[model samples]
Target chain A: MEFKKYSKTLFFGATLAVLAGCGGNDAVTQDDVNASTDGQVQPVITSDGSNGDSAVNGEQLGQEAQNLQDQASSAIAALPEVETVYFDFDTSVIRDDSREVLDLHVAYLNANPAQNVVLEGHADERGTREYNNALGERRGNAVKNYFMVQGVSADRIEVISYGEEKPAVIGHNNAAWSKNRRVEIKY
Target chain B: MPFKKWIKAAAFTLLCVTQQAVADLTIEITQGNDRATPVAVVPFAWLGQSPLPEDVAQIVSDDLERSGLIRPLSRSDMLSLPSQKSEIYFRDWSLLKQDYLLIGQVRPSVSPGVLTIQFELYDVVRQTRVLGEVISGKVSELRSRAHYISDKVFEHLTGIEGAFSTRLAYVTMRKDEAGQNKYELKVADADGRREKSILTTYKPILSPSWSPDAQHLAYVSFETGRPGIFIQNVYSGKRRQLTAFKGLNGAPSWSPDGEKLAVVLSKDGNPELYVIDLNTYKMKRLTKHYAIDTEPEWSPDGERIMFTSSRSGGPQIYQLDLVSGETERLTFEGNYNARARFSPDGTEIYFVHQKDGIFHIAAQELANNRLRILTQTPLDESPSVSPNGSMLIYATQEGSRGYLGAVSVNGQIRYRLPSQRADVREPAWSPFLTN
Candidate 1:
């Protein structure tokens, strides 16, 4: 647990310095993505993994860090790209693909503690209105719980359930229902 | 608690109100009893006016025909216009297979702006007069007086008090010229006439519940960008926000005595049920469960509350004994059941039930636990019982637009109320208005 905490902070600090290096421009440029992979994040993971070891032995450590960096970067990059997580009818269990997306959100929140996020939960127009309200709350809470487990601050996270009142798509078909049953991550 | 509270209550005065009185609902009986007793309603003789403001007899005939208990004959089929009992020949009605006949006359009363309405209901087969009455009201109240006569005649015929005089509240939504959705909370007569908008907002309005006295309506409004419960006086246009809790201030239902409200609030944490006293604004939490528990409705006697809860792995109706605080599950036959309300007689509970992926209105008898599906339409919801306990009105979809539909308690009769331009939903049948 201690090593995990140290590595988390180290990763966050390196991410911030890289972010500052590309300051005054908040948009995610191609250069920013390449820099995150090839320059700042990769070197720190190798140096941090090797500690006081000799430079000759750094190659083995660098190779190991490269694998870890690639996995983490890919997962993190996939987060903001996926704005919504869909759920099965009447169920709130997060899917496996959603776990990776939430992990990216957790890393972003850990890196920027001052930021806040709101998880908007929705459902298809089925059953009763009040029951759907409760169902939407359960879905939003499921996402909120996953965020907390990923080390996101509970206070910075808020949840609102629109229930079945607001539909992402206006239709009565199964396609609309599947799209409507979701939790939207809003920052 | 303070004088400032009354000032805060007046904030709703700024809301926009629009009413449309141009058209009334055209009755189309989708189904009825094959053995329904045939009846005839002749055009009333108009006196002391260039023309009658409303077709009083037509309104009465439509009300009776829509009840599913009686069939009214077409005006062209009437051999003679009879505004009095002396002009009626019982043999003519018998030839038309009419078991009953109704005749009326409208005239200017001595009291200015008032009209005198006299109507007679007769049993043609028995060759006897069932009942008669003279109603005095403003000229503008012609439709209501017609409904009043329908109620009296219905009571004399079926032994069940008529709900024709009551009103219904519902929500209508439409997109404005700006392409933004605009919602209006409207109250119309039981016959869907003279619809008056009580509240209008750009946000969604839902779950309208009527006070027992029929003077106020409690509904959930999202005007403040968050869900909040508001109680509005249907007459004076006065309204006050009952609660604007952080999460889920929804599903407000009036206690039978009108002293408190059962609401669903999530201010504490997860969604749960709570009852709020109207006098003191005090709230008492009712359920303590990890699962979702909401949609609380009071029994007619006010001794118990039926609500929807997923504690048993799926949505089902559960009864909570208010005095003893013991909750017992009431529905087990279906995998999904919700939005249950006790029948006015307290012998059954009507709810939204799902089967074969289609949602319909259903009723469960309290004595034998006999569950009967009452509707065949898709996405039927918000079932509300009439004050007389003979009919139910619920929200349903016709094609892609929302509309209100009514079905007799026995599921023998059905009708739909659809506005030409907007989607109507969430009907709350008002209680009997005692003058």
Candidate 2:
């Protein structure tokens, strides 16, 4: 299911605890990605049309527009093939392989300011329905928090947990459960 | 209670006999007492012009047999069917090795449509009468009269209040003609008969909780394309939405006094337990933790609330005192423990505990912190206790279908109540009815 952008006060305490325990402090940010890839990185730009000192010649304006289009196209091209992240049973901790996919999503969100994404979280049907709903919400928030740390705007990301109500696959085996416990990035 | 008015004003006429094609829930006693006291329930004498509408003695016998505490003898095994103390011969029952004997008579009263029942219980070996009583009811209430007699006899023999008249509320999921799953909330007699669909929806419905007065049921429904908590009058079918927050609104449990509901809401932030006043519709947040905290259940005395929280890294049961505002963890043995409920008397707590990768229903004594697993089947969840605290009903898997099962508090006896076509789950036992 898709959800519209909703501004919520994301709880960073859990994110901080998760980061502290996982000890990877090397999460890539928008600035790092820009510095490493773009040769002519422009100055910080806000959501509005122009940055400070808006007066500029038409040639310079056209040149800046070209640069922005090139950066956005390259960012979209850099996205990973996977769009969904899988978690361990009963735990919302993101795995190493899933982090790469989330990084791609973060970069894409940064390049396209008008675009918003929804994180759909799900769980296996092994626990009580209400408890699984809470677990699914935690998993969705885990992904949302990761995007926040990677320089994605919190308002651009909405989350909703379907819990065990909706399964990606219809089976009771471990193979089905592994696929069901996932967060899909829908843009 | 106001529920009587609802039943009287119900719009949908109950098709009790017309829908008998789908078999009613039948109980299969999986285990029982090894040395159950052998008893004989003699067929009652009918003094009316026509045969009695019901066999009161037979109904009582079935009640006792379902309890698993006593084994009633077959009617064919009895040498004589006695209806009075003077007609019962002590040597006859003693020869059958019966420990207890029950005899009764039903006669039409002078008042039109009224019937009077007289019954007595005797100790066969001791040759002493244990109980004698007379009950009056209309002809249509014969089944209820039988259950009342069973309750009285049970209390006299076992010292535990009988739960024969209580009811069970559960959810059933089935596929509609369009091949889409349809969920329904149903209530049935404790013996697993006379089921009525209280609510039906195309979307999923979870967690059916009975009000303390047994008049209303509060559950989470996804009818509006989003989850919301709704309270509906079981008889009248009148329903009102309670919560429809943006993120999560689920797990509604009524307080002891029925003035408030403990619910889980995520509107403020992460999933947290909140107590909402029924009169004002105002909410008071109970937990401020970042980790998931939900599934709050009230204690019988209204002084404490037990809930499930993952604040300690993984989900576990926790108790919060409303008066003192002090919170303490209650589970440590398992890595996962959720959906905890307090026994009616408040002496013990039942919950779903995961052990060795399989989920089972478990009980923990509040006095010494001792825990005992009660179910042998894996994937058991939603354990609800009877009003008298004698039996617990929960949901478990039988092959691929979900079914409801009951187990005694001592874990000595067990029974299964499987649905005919749908998957039955999320059973909530109603409190003892005073009416």
Docking class of 1: incorrect
Q: Global lDDT for candidate 2? A: 0.76
Question: Model 2, A148: alpha-carbon shift in Å?
Answer: 5.0
lDDT of 1 by residue, B50-131 (tens): 6766788888888887787887898889899999988999999999999899998999999999999999888899988888
Q: After superposition, which runs of candidate 1 have C-alpha atoms over 4 Å from their true positions?
A: A1-79, B1-25
List the pairs of residues colliding in candidate 1.
Answer: none
What TM-score does the A-chain of candidate 1 achieve? 0.58
lDDT, candidate 2, at B144: 77
Which pairs clash (backbone N, Cα, C closer than 3 Å) in model 2?
A: none
